[model samples]
Target: MQPLADRLRPRTLDEVAGQQHLIGASGVLRKIVESGVIPNMVFYGPPGIGKTTVANIISQVTSRRLYRLNGTTASIGDVKAIVDELDTFLTPDGALLYLDEIQYFNKKQQQTLLSHMENGKLTLIASTTENPYFYIYPAVLSRLTVFEFKPLKKEDVESVVLRAFDTLRGESGESFVLEQGVAGYLAAACAGDVRKAVGAAELAWLTCPPEDGQRRITLAACEAVAQRSSMRYDRDGDSHFDLLSALHKSIRGSDPDAAVHYLARLLLADDLPSVCRRLLAIASEDVGLAWPQAVSIVKSCVDSALQLGMPEARLPLTEAALLLATAPKSNSALMAIERAIADIQAGRIGDVPDHLKDGHYAGAEKLGHAVGYRYPHDFEHHYTPQQYLPDELKGAHYYDYGPNKFEQANKNYWDEIKKKHR
Candidate 1:
């Protein structure tokens, strides 16, 4: 028996589910199809979002010769062989070449396709799960129109489930009824992936006993087959963004346990890069001078992520998470920048005081530059505030030291220096 995904593979755009933004009546792709003027395009999206299906649809609609290659398995020689085949069947009307996982193609292999696409020898349609702007070569990217495909929605997944169930009943002639909750459960567990939804449905049918003709699929059965009780935490989805928000708030709130829990969730979901980036933000925003080492630790973790990649990189990420959770919290540095930005946006522009302007340049001294600027090093504790700020905001104070240990110590140091100056 054929697998559900294969059995239900869409043969036309009408049969393909979801991605209304691309395939709807007034969608960009629909316009391209109606015009019969398909350009070289790169399909940037997650897996099983009908990239290949759409490519096949285009080939069918246009009656173009289609040559498909899997980047994971196809060799350079295989690519050349296909190109050779294209040459044999070469006509005034060009052919379409579909490359799967185009990111997996090394620089040289990607370069090989440049001329073919440029000269219109083949209408190139490439697909990848990764962002092409980062992974694809610049030269190749310049010549391609990039289309992003989003994951299938829950309703779309449910629709596919019903269609699959109908197909199964029609083929098997066995009355199989899915419980009311089973469809929703299966759809949710699939995480916006139609392929997984069909697989789970098929698994439930296969595992049912032959004697139980009236067997109904349950949540337990679905969970057992899907290997998850509910939707998995998608790093690019709502849960990911929400958890990061909570993590940042917890760190700012100085709640170590809550911060740790959020960190653990992100780690388990394999969102290490985003975790590191957010931690870096927290370091500057919440830690600042209160715990200066926190920023360095976060930076080091980001570097470690670049060096180690996944699995091993989780270690440094864990260290950074713990440090951020326990670090003394302050928002003074964050407030300082926020205030500066607010002033700028409010049209509080100020000229560089003549005394502070560059003096090393030829005409600097003639323009009264560096005329009255005091050298702070010559003063006690290297401290001086000789009108550094503009006249309009001379007495403006942005950073108010918080009640953290490091902040209090810094406040004391500044106070003593101010006393000497006064």
Candidate 2:
């Protein structure tokens, strides 16, 4: 018997659960299919969304025989066999080739399809759970129109779950009634994955015991099958980077709630090192010199986290996140370094001023190293103004004081000392 997910596979665009943006009455894809000229395209998004279903529908609408291949196992030979069929009387005009998880295909394998796509021997619809721009070679990527399939909404999942339950009930030849809210519960628990929701509904129906001569599918049964809400995270994929980016941005934006929320999500995936590394970077890159001690404090938190390990590690990490969110924010240090690098890259580098050059070496005096240098400790307030930057960068300011208490205080002290020197 086929899995419920496979049994429920949508055979037409109208049967697909979501992706109204692509298959709705006015959707771009719908218009393309109606025009009877389906071009090569790539579907990019998470799984259990309707990429394959839509591709299948496009093949049917365009009256082309569909050939499905999984990139994980399909070899160059498999593709060639399909190409061989193009010359057959049965597939005279051409055929649609559906490649799933296309990212798994190596560059050479991906390239092999280019000639076929260009010659119209194959109309390609490739799908990936990754960003194609990063995985697909430009030669192949440039040939396909890319469409992004978003996760199904809760209501859409609920509708699909109810439909699956009805199908299961009829197929089993048993009387079963879904408890109120069972579909909605499964929908929310599945986290916008229509296939998962359908599977859960099928499981709930099978595991449910008959009461009063009819089986009752309850929310509890659905919960047991669904378990924890599905989380779309791959440590090596965009989900990993996307969550890390969210956590960092939340901290940088000064929202402790959002910061901790994303942190918990990453930690739940057991990605301790990534979360720790990102937090440490946030301390210096985002908090920066505004609270110079932030680096040290975050470092200690990270060290303790590494030693304590997960669950417990979350404690110190949480503290670190809260502290960073509450701390004064600054990017002046980050911007300062960036500006300096830009100058160097643009050939603005000048010879080191003689007074700032290394003078401890023998023969340095002959080269005028450290000449005319003023020792600040020999003056009042340990302060003296002298040329420190390269001669070409004289009077150039790379760092402007960030509008924070600690920075402003340091800025005031330096300003006063320079005023006294003047």
Question: Residue 234 deviation, candidate 1, in Å?
Answer: 10
lDDT of 1 by residue, 68-133 (tens): 888898788876775666556454466788999998899988887778788887788999877788
lDDT score, candidate 2? 0.90
CA lDDT, candidate 2, residue 405: 89
The number of the candidate with the highest TM-score is 2
Indicate the TM-score of model 1. Answer: 0.67
Candidate 1 displacement at residue 157 in angstroms: 0.8
lDDT score for candidate 1 against the true structure: 0.81
The residue-by-residue lDDT of candidate 2 on 1-422, one tens digit each, is 99988888988778888889988999998899889899999999988888887877788776778889999999999988887888688788788999999999998899888888999889999999899999999999999999999989999998888889788878876788888889889998888888788888888988997776688998888889998767778999999999999999999999999999999999888999998999999999999988999999999999999999988999999999999998989999999999999999999999989888889999998999988999989988987888888889888878989999889999998998788768
| Strongest candidate by lDDT | 2
The TM-scores of all predictions, comma-separated, are: 0.67, 0.94
Error of 1 at 79 (Å): 1.8
